[model samples]
Target: MSAPDVFAPARLGPVTLRNRTVKAATFEGRTPEGLVTDGLIDYHLAVARGGIGLTTVAYLSVAPEGRTHREVIVVGEHSLGGLTRLTDAIHETGAAVAAQVGHAGPVANGRSNGVKAIAASSMPSPLSMQMVKAATEADLTRVTKAYVAAARTLVRAGFDVLELHMAHSYLISSFLAPGLNRRKDGWAGSLENRARLGRQVARAVRDEVGDEVAVTAKVSLSDGFKGGVTTADGLAFAQLLEQDGTVDALQMSGGSSLMNPMYLFRGGAPVKEFAASMPLPVRLGMRTPVGRSFMKTYPFEEAYFRDKALQFRAGLSLPLMLLGGINRRDTMEQAMADGFDFVAMGRAVLREPDLVNRLQSERVESGVCIHCNRCMPTIYSGTRCPIIDLELAAHRDPLPQI
Candidate 1:
């Protein structure tokens, strides 16, 4: 068969998307006081109105310390009304909405959270400048329950889907990382032990939500570093997740936010913009010999992860969503032709939320996002395209500043 049209509807587990387009979860620093803000809702609503099939609300932390910033959506009681409003607004725009849930673990902003960071093993944390504690069996149990609770909260909030953030060196990915997880017991050693935490959390989420909601997971296809979870292990883990019945769909992603941070986005973070946006301590840390070496950059390329993701498509039977560096009509067509179920856009959609509607035309080439990765640092200020903001300002004034 020929490549399916990009704008076609897609069914994801219990939910049905209006189109194959998914606005991938990009952290919008819109939450404040641990509650959803109108800005957060408006952000997703704009994407939904822009004609996305499903717009994901990003980084709803399972617990407080899981957040990379002090201000983020914490899965809790008072959030019910705001999230309900968010879902309603998106639904009104004729789009489905999903919530991306995760725990940041060692990558968390413990200083801002006023707690020591926890990880899969006790390790020297350059960021916190202290040894991060390894989670105990009790801690593991607690975190697993947190996932269950987050799923319930999402269901109550009227979210049609819950995308678990298991990739990017978070709580789950930390354990999966062999370099980070060196435990000798149940939580480490072999791949099976290392993958236990993710499996447990996924099972708990399924038990909690049952068929009432669709659950998807974003998993690292590779950590892009030595002694880390390799591409081979990532495929094994993906197979295990399917065997455990933990996901309705699997989204492929790579890189460690702590290790090969630049590997996630090949173009790399704009260091100058990142430093300018950081607090004094983080700013200074980035200049440190260690930090400077850690924040590496890579060249920009379209469909950056396609090569590895194709390897995944070859092995797994579960539906997969292709992410990373998809910015053009032809790229989406390639994904369809490759037998991928969905295509997710982060910077592409951020640059042009209406890019989906515009993609129907063969004349549309790609999004206006240059992929400079300048927006990486804006996590502290609300993640957005600086270019788009400048464009909006120019449109409002209709004049140049002298």
Candidate 2:
């Protein structure tokens, strides 16, 4: 099956996308002082103009304390001007814009604003393995308020969509992951309890934003970690969200922070290395980067995971946004044919901002993303996007005439 309407416009709640191609969130470390800069504006505008249906701003923290890094954009009253400017720029190209709102949880080093990080439990991060302070009831209240406030701000700033970042072992994800969230409290014991905060945040945001803005969540179907949130848990959560009508769409993803970096962003860890490192119990279905080359070479009858996600959504009637490793037109078309309403592209959009336009015109050549994961490392470096050659060139030789 091929894409149903690859080049056609489709409605997503209130907004319409020019094409099915969405430029997924990729951090461009251009923000300074938690504010958007000219470079950031130029970067997104380039992609928007390139003909993608939508482009999401990466890692916009709902609260100062929730920030992933110092360079991440802060969605607060003070950030309205810059965010509005960004939305207007993207709108100029007829592309919709979504803001990814999240708190980094244990991943938050408080390096951005010097605030202490909070989490569902006091478990240490796998990367740093440093114990994070557990979130008190008051802290949870503040976190919920922050998400509502940020959603309101995004609406005011003219964003067309609000995507709750509930995946990749962030605060919401940590709450969902049983392995990390060992709290005996009401917000931690059962699956229903673990989903409470996310539900509250979504409800608050919806109330504030009203029915005008599209609300969605990027959710991990499984943590891919020992004793973590499983696919069954994810499905139950999805059902709850559907029953409450809290979210308009669900972006299915997998893996956890310490366990599966590749699941957060496609083509990160080499497939073989990731699979080999996994515990034997979960190694049966594992496929790594080394295996990807071979998988592409061999003629396989089975559909990929992206295709299988459609099966997962069988009972639910909500629109689904399929992501992860969707690079080529044929694969995207296959997703659409399989009943997926939308498709998202991350690294490919980063390497070639105009990929959508090239695909639409049947002129797309090889994508620029080398799958090196160099871009991911840049988030911690205070700037994102290592592939911006023009920026690198300018740094190498400043304007001599000036």
Candidate 3:
């Protein structure tokens, strides 16, 4: 059989995407006040107007304590109006929108959020340099309810999809990682128990939305280090998700936000740039031996995660979205030929939001992104490509709202 066309319409749950290309969720750094701003809307508008099938707004935490920093949006009634406006604007460009909901867990900055980080078990939080407390049963119940609340709010905001962040060593993924989760209670030990929180959240969100929109998950294929979830354990957890019959698709990703993040976006590490972006105290820490260990580097390759994701593709029948270092049309076509349902691009799209349209019209060999990964540090102020002139970005034509 011929490979499925990369530009053709595709169904994700009940939503029909204009094309199979998705602008995967990358923290925009536009919401500095924990609420939507013109910058945030314009960021997604750039991708929508450029012709992405779906553009995901990233890192909407379920609770304030769950936020990675003070500036992260806490999905709730307070932010409803701004979120609604953001989604409506994207729909005007004829592209679907999704919300990436997650709890930062050990990844949360306690100093910034003015709350202690909560994890499956107490551990030293490197972000805040404080001891993270173990989540009690009451805390678990509150978090579950928060997930449901976030789902309802996203649906109300006109989002066509809800992607539960179950990867990157956040609350859910942290619980699933044996090295991070040392709890002896029902939420730990066996793989089934460790996976319970993620399954419950997915089922709850699905029950709340009930086909109103697509329900998907971004799950880790591995934690990218020893003592983390292995490929075997990751696959087993994915099977549990499939058996639950709740999630419509799974976007495969890896690495721990708390530890080895470069495992997910392999390229130049940009260690010096990352240090320079931080405050003086933290800057000094980043230059230390231990700090350098946290910023591990890896070589870049197109479809870097394809070999590992293929294992899930072969083992499970659920729809899968292939991510990590996809910068060319042939790579996307290859994913479709391999039976994947969608292809998600992060840095490549950030480098050129209009690359999808260019790929269709210009027939370019590949995107202009060099995978320098310098853009990684810019997430602190505003997620942007330095190659693009700041003055030009400030003066670009704005899209008309319908």
C-alpha TM-scores of all predictions: 0.95, 0.84, 0.95
lDDT digits (tens) for residues 104-135 of candidate 2? 88767553356767789986433232356899
The digit string of per-residue lDDT tens for model 3 on 337-380 reads 99999999998889898989988775696898888888988997
**lDDT, candidate 1, 1-402, per-residue tens:** 787777888789988788888999888988868787888888897788878898998888888878876787788887878899889988999999999998988888677777777889887655655567898898888889998988998899999999998888888989999888988888898889899999999999988998887899999988887867788889999999999987999989988877777888878568787778777766666666656766687898998899999999999999999999999888998999999999999988888888888886554777778988878888767888888777788889556768
C-alpha local distance difference test of each model: 0.85, 0.74, 0.90
Among all windows of ten consecutive residues in candidate 3, which has the lowest summed lDDT?
A: 281-290
lDDT of 2: 0.74
Pairs of residues at least 3 apart in sequence or in different chains that clash in candidate 3: none
Residue 374: error of model 2 in Å? Answer: 2.7
- RMSD values for the candidates in order, in angstroms, are 1.9, 7.0, 4.4
Candidate 1: RMSD to truth: 1.9
Regions more than 4 Å wrong, model 3 = 284-290, 390-402
